[model samples]
Target: MYGLEQYLLSMIYHYRYWGLFTVLSFGMIGVPVPDEFIMAFSGFQTSIGHMNFVKTLFFASLGSFVGMNLSYWIGRSLGIPFLHRIAPFLHMNENKIRRAEGWFQRFGDRLIVIGYFFPGFRHFVAYFSGMSELNYARYTILSGIGALLWSTTFITLGNLLGTHWQGIIALLHRYLSRGGIILALFVGIIYLYTSNRNKAKTHEE
Candidate 1:
């Protein structure tokens, strides 16, 4: 396990931006690569002048966008059967899948915007969004925002921490879930407020 991680790190060191992109894209597809660690490492690279911050963030976001959309389309086209067959291979558990579905039920489409902060949640949420037949354009917009927010949060941390990033990485992962929940609820509240206001306006007219 450690060897694979070291190899991935070496890849990032040698190949720079593309390596980071490839890792994040496959990680989104449930490839077992360490997505957050690599992203933070990429940020560290930027600090050392091995990579450009803008380019790294752009590619990381783009990779996640591509991989997630692929998952969405796969779930939409093949439905549950493909996920059932591949779930074992991909290590996707029922509890996690069910949890994601429940969040979708409770939060509606807002989960897609902040799901990226919760590690594997983003993967399953994308599939649920497609299976639930959420509009593609809407999904894309939320996923894009998620990908950007996720990239910026971790990569910036990595860049800022420099040598100490590894120590705080685990803490970030631990706390990020709570932060995501708060943000999701905040967005949900705003959405509800706006929707109610619009309805009231229409009724008044």
Candidate 2:
């Protein structure tokens, strides 16, 4: 996981869209990959004429959506019985699952969408949503919207920052463990604000 940037850059340099999709899919599956950095770096590549912007966004969103749903299905199919059987080995228990369920209840469906922005949260959101028996329709809608907002933010940052993305990403990586949720919230706000502005412009036009 450490010193991954060099390898990620190389993969992006070679595989392009396929590389983007593969990395993010696994990252969301709990692999220790720098997903944000990958998207941002892809954006940087797009800005420099090394990749296509629309494709980057498309694949990034697609990879995340697929990965998240996969996690959800695993939880759903595996169900509680399986987890309970394995819990002791994994150091998880019914108590912990119930506690997480409480948080989900308080937050409700919003977690599906917002979870994408918060790194580790996304994986848990999908898995728990399934374990909690959340409706597939609601899960898809919330998760899709969240994935779009999350992917576009970092991708746009990459494009806008261009050559300077690495410095910003380096700074972000340093603070991510502490400020991840805060940063996710900030990005979500930006996404909402941008969407509103665009809607207003369309209305005016």
Candidate 3:
């Protein structure tokens, strides 16, 4: 993963749009790739005259929409039972699934728009939304808006930063990676803590 990030960073320094699009597409489709960093670095590249902001944003959004739709279709076709078989490996739990389903039920469709900004929630929300049999047209609309917003925001940031964009991106990559590791550790700790608590409570009962 680290090597890939370095490779991407190098690519962004050269072919900004291609690098950004590739990273975002793969990342959205559940690859352990750094999509955010790619956007930020692409923005940095723009500052240095290697990229166009509008084009970068367009391609980034397009890639995200395509990748997410693919995942949605997979989940929709395979259904929940198949998803359950792969859930553990993906760190998806029943509680998370239920929560996503609940969100879909309440929102009817808005979750797709909102979910785009929320990491860890975005990918599964699409799948669960599909499983809920959300209208394809509506899903497309909401997801498209979300993708547009996310892509525009990051790419614009890159454009604005310009030359110093690389430094900013490097710092962000370090922090984002650290943050992901911390989040993973936190989830593990919470799972263990809850399990121990439940066992104790069960004994008392």
Candidate 4:
């Protein structure tokens, strides 16, 4: 992974603009790429006069919007059949799907905004939002706000921390590396608790 990071960093150094766009787009599509790192790198690059902050933010946000929409369309078109096919390997059950759907329905548009901050749920929310056929205008509005917030935060962090950027980059990388593990544990706990509650309800029934 370190080598991959180095390689990507090198690419960013050489092909800066396109590299940033490609990385951001792919990351939003559920690819295991360090999108945040690219944004931060762009920030550092901008600080050093290699790139422009406004352009970097625009491209990053555009890529995110495109990638998210693609995921949303895929979920809308594929629906439950696609999910069921992948469920066994993922160990996801119908109850979990139902629960997620319920939650999405209850929260509605708010989920899209918050989901952007949640690594595991980001891609899923896009699709779920589509499945729910959420208002396109509302989804776009909420999602755009999310994209702006997330992109600006990291990019600005990179710009402000320019010279000492390495430290912040290291901190971010550590957080990203462990983020999925933490989310997995949280999801597991939620699933187990929900499952037990469901079982008890069934027994009562």
Best by TM-score: 4
Model 4 clashing residue pairs (backbone): none
Select the stronger candidate by TM-score from 1 and 4.
4
Estimate candidate 4's alpha-carbon lDDT, on a 0 to 1 scale: 0.76
Tens digit per residue, CA lDDT, model 2, 26-139? 888888888889999999999999999999999999888888888888888987777688889978778665644554554547767756766676777788777777788888
**Model 4 Cα lDDT, one tens digit per residue, 1-205:** 6777788878877887777777777788788777777778788889999988998888878778777888777777887667778878978788776765655565656657656665666887788788766777888888888888878877888999998777887787677557756764665576567667877999999
In terms of lDDT, which candidate is stronger, 2 or 4?
2
Q: What is the C-alpha lDDT of each candidate?
A: 0.80, 0.80, 0.72, 0.76
What stretches of model 1 exceed 4 Å from their correct place? 80-106, 175-205
**lDDT tens readout by residue for model 3, 1-205:** 6798899788767766766677777778788766766787776666676777788888889888987887778768977677678879989898665544554555546557655655555776677767767778878888889899988777777777776666776676566556655654654475456656766998999
Query: lDDT-based ranking, best first?
Result: 1, 2, 4, 3
Each candidate structure's TM-score, on Cα atoms with residue i matched to residue i, is: 0.74, 0.78, 0.70, 0.78
List the lowest-lDDT window of 10 residues for candidate 4.
Answer: 99-108
Query: lDDT for model 3, on a 0 to 1 scale?
Result: 0.72
List, residue by residue over 79-166, the lDDT tens digit for candidate 1. Answer: 6556567778877677544544444555657778767877666776787777766789988998999899989998999999999888
Evaluate model 4: give its TM-score: 0.78
